[model samples]
Target: KPFVRRLRGDLLAHGVPRVWLDEAEIDIGDSLIAKIDEGMKLSRYIAVVLSKKSIDAPWVKKELDVAMNREITSGEVVVLPLLYEPCDLPEFLKGKMYADFSKPDEYEAMLAKLLRRLRIT
Candidate 1:
């Protein structure tokens, strides 16, 4: 998974501890809401990998809704999305700034700009 790889890369580069779920065999079905709730509560930053496949993914929607609700309620969580390819950012994340990883130089530039936009390094 590109997302899992990229996230692991970022965490390693930044020396941040992270928990990855893709490798796990745990099932998330009827308890998806509770799982997402826990993930939202545990993670400081939540990234929803948007794509043709992810557009209708229930989990993606849940993640987005959880992040948005958290932002509205607590104003502490951040959604930092890294676009792996060209795709609509959906209405939920439409207005908010997002990173475009379409090209190396361009993505790098956007990364710096986004850092400035988010007031982080």
Candidate 2:
């Protein structure tokens, strides 16, 4: 989750007014599903970090499902895929362009691209 924390920090530093990181947003007694659902609803875009481990996570799948549903219902792009490691992407994400963070040397460039997509700069 270090990557996520760093990403969140960078995003905030780059003028993203609000970022939804579960650890920061959700309290100890909070319901994970409900909080996540609420976060998805409130967010303009959902950034899905794809790594070998996260790809098979059940919670990640569920979150992706929610993000996909939001995209379908709104008829707009809401999911931003961030590839953190080399892994086979889900079928739905195959054709979508992602910000590649796999190569450490390319992080700043990829982050700039992502910010542009986010229309922050």
Candidate 3:
């Protein structure tokens, strides 16, 4: 969660429009699934933080599934994964490349790689 917040801040600082599904952004009556779908539609790329926690999350799986669908249909790189911890990736994600974040010391380098992947300079 901390990494997600930090990444969101970093992207915002870099003038990248990012949509985060954290609790703070949720309204009292907001529909979680609807919000996620809307956000996915608005985003050019979806960054899935593949940590141990996220890997087990159903919501994350759903989001990734949606993103993968977009990628297949549009024939573009829509899902960019950040592997924050060692975990068995989903079958679909196994063949896709991901930015490694397992080594804490290499955070900046990984961030740079992510930005380059996003073509954000």
Candidate 4:
């Protein structure tokens, strides 16, 4: 939660345009599915925070699937995986590198790596 908030803030501070959906941004009467679909369509990249909790989350799985498909169809890396903890990564992500953030001390290194991966100046 806090890590994600921090990441979002850091990304924004770097002048990277980002779209993140939280309960506060989603209206109570709005459709979550529609919002997610629109966000994915407009986003240049999808940063998936992988952890034990998110790995089993259905919505996360769905988001990963969509991102992976976009990567295949668009012939570009759309999904950027940020590993928060050790877990069995899905087959699609196996053998691929991730931005490691398992250690608090690694935040700067990981953020740099992530920005490089994003091609941010």
Per lDDT, the best of the predicted structures is 2
- lDDT of model 2 at position 79: 94
How large is the C-alpha RMSD of every model relative to the true structure?
3.7, 0.7, 1.4, 1.3
Ranking of all predicted structures according to TM-score, beginning with the best and ending with the worst = 2, 4, 3, 1
Off by more than 4 A, model 1 = 24-36, 104-121
True-structure lDDT of candidate 2 = 0.95
Across residues 2-88, which tens digit of lDDT does each residue of candidate 2 receive? 999999999999999999999999999999889998998889999999999999999999999989988999899999999999999
Which candidate gets the maximum TM-score versus the true structure?
A: 2
Clashing pairs in model 1, backbone N/Cα/C closer than 3 A = none
Per-residue alpha-carbon lDDT of candidate 3 for residues 8-82, written as tens digits (9 for 90 to 100): 788778767665655656687888878777777878989999977898898888889889999999999999989
How do the residues 1-121 of candidate 1 rate in per-residue lDDT, one tens digit apiece?
Answer: 8655754565445445554454342374637556557666787777666677786788788778778887878776477776767787788777776677666568557656645544456
Task: Evaluate model 1: give its TM-score.
Answer: 0.70
TM-score, cand. 3 vs. native: 0.91
Clashing pairs in 2: none
By summed lDDT, the worst window of 10 consecutive residues in model 4 runs over 17-26
How should the candidates be ordered by lDDT, best one leading? 2, 4, 3, 1
- Per-residue lDDT value at 60 in model 1: 81
Candidate 3 ranges with C-alpha deviation above 4 Å: none
For candidate 3, the per-residue lDDT at 86 reads 92
